[model samples]
Target: MDMDNFREMFLTEAAEHLQLMVDLLVQLDSDPQDQDGIDALFRGAHSIKGMAASMEYPETARLAHHLEDHLADCRQLGQISGVEIDWLLEAVDLLELLLGDIRNGRPERNVDSFIAGISKQPEAAVDCVAETKTVELTACGRGQLIQLQLQESVAIPGPRFLVLLKKLADLGTILESTPSTEDLLQGDAPNQLLVRL
Candidate 1:
């Protein structure tokens, strides 16, 4: 395969695996005792690491490998706390950002801080508190809802969608999004994506 073709393939598959990892992490956050979720999360991280290494994205691969090892340790211990889940989610966000950089032809950014933060092992007891806090929306406090139509011929739309999602999240709390983050990460490539602030 052409190098361009290889890069495209890697981006497409990496996006799917990253999304799967995020979804599994979210599930694990809610139910830390779910062994299936833990196993799936480990596999997803491991897959991403392998793919990144094959693509010669050493930084991305190293980050993924660190996460894979962390998850494997969690699986062996049979517990993960809410704070740890938050850290993992943050790591996923960083991974998505790094992938976006590669897609945009930008140099890979250093992930040392993030890697160092999550590298530490957590205590044996798991905290079951929710990482995401529920907010009550008032009638007059509703934020704007925006709909975006991406070009149908766009290459690797999944990571692009995630970049947009992260940008939106930075501005304000996202109430909801269509084709949802989970759907987008799971390889859903609908032309239209709706977001509520």
Candidate 2:
């Protein structure tokens, strides 16, 4: 297919993902313990990010990346707060606007300011996970399981996780991960990383 065909497909799928995220976010607002719903939201964002990156839509990809990271945090908390839900809804609305621009053949909007605002917001503490480290040496399985905890002092754990993954790749092949490689690359700054290698 041609570039235009690809763009149309991306736009259609992205819109569907956005709709799913919004519905799930609303459901989360009512019942915060909806783990499946939250996972769906994360998947929606991740799908959008991957598609946007493939389409070379940096702004859309960047916004989707931030949204995915935010969803990851919510997933770790096992609940979503009213305030966080509000922020997510607003972000989704902005994403809709961005999609509208793309559909209309307009310039992509600058989402950096919006992304910067997310960092300014107070972050949830994952102190419980930070204090624990686990490792399992599996002689029969595919590889050993290792869990690494990040200090609260680390400003950006996502890039650090990526670096660690790269370093570990040099030693041996990585078998599996909890959040997955794409999540880390999309900047999901988790307090701990679980990898089997």
List the global CA lDDT of all models. Answer: 0.73, 0.76
- Per-residue alpha-carbon lDDT of model 1 for 130-192, expressed as tens digits? 122234446656767676665433334554455566656878998888879988867786656
TM-score for predicted model 2 compared with the true structure: 0.60
Model 1 whole-model lDDT (C-alpha atoms): 0.73
Steric clash count of candidate 2: 0
TM-score of each: 0.63, 0.60
Give candidate 2 regions above 4 Å deviation: 122-197
| Candidate 2, lDDT over the whole model | 0.76
Q: Pick the candidate with the highest lDDT.
A: 2
Error of 1 at 13 (Å): 0.8
Model 1 stretches with alpha carbons more than 4 Å out? 120-197
lDDT (Cα, 0-100) at 85 in candidate 2: 65
- The top-ranked prediction according to TM-score is 1
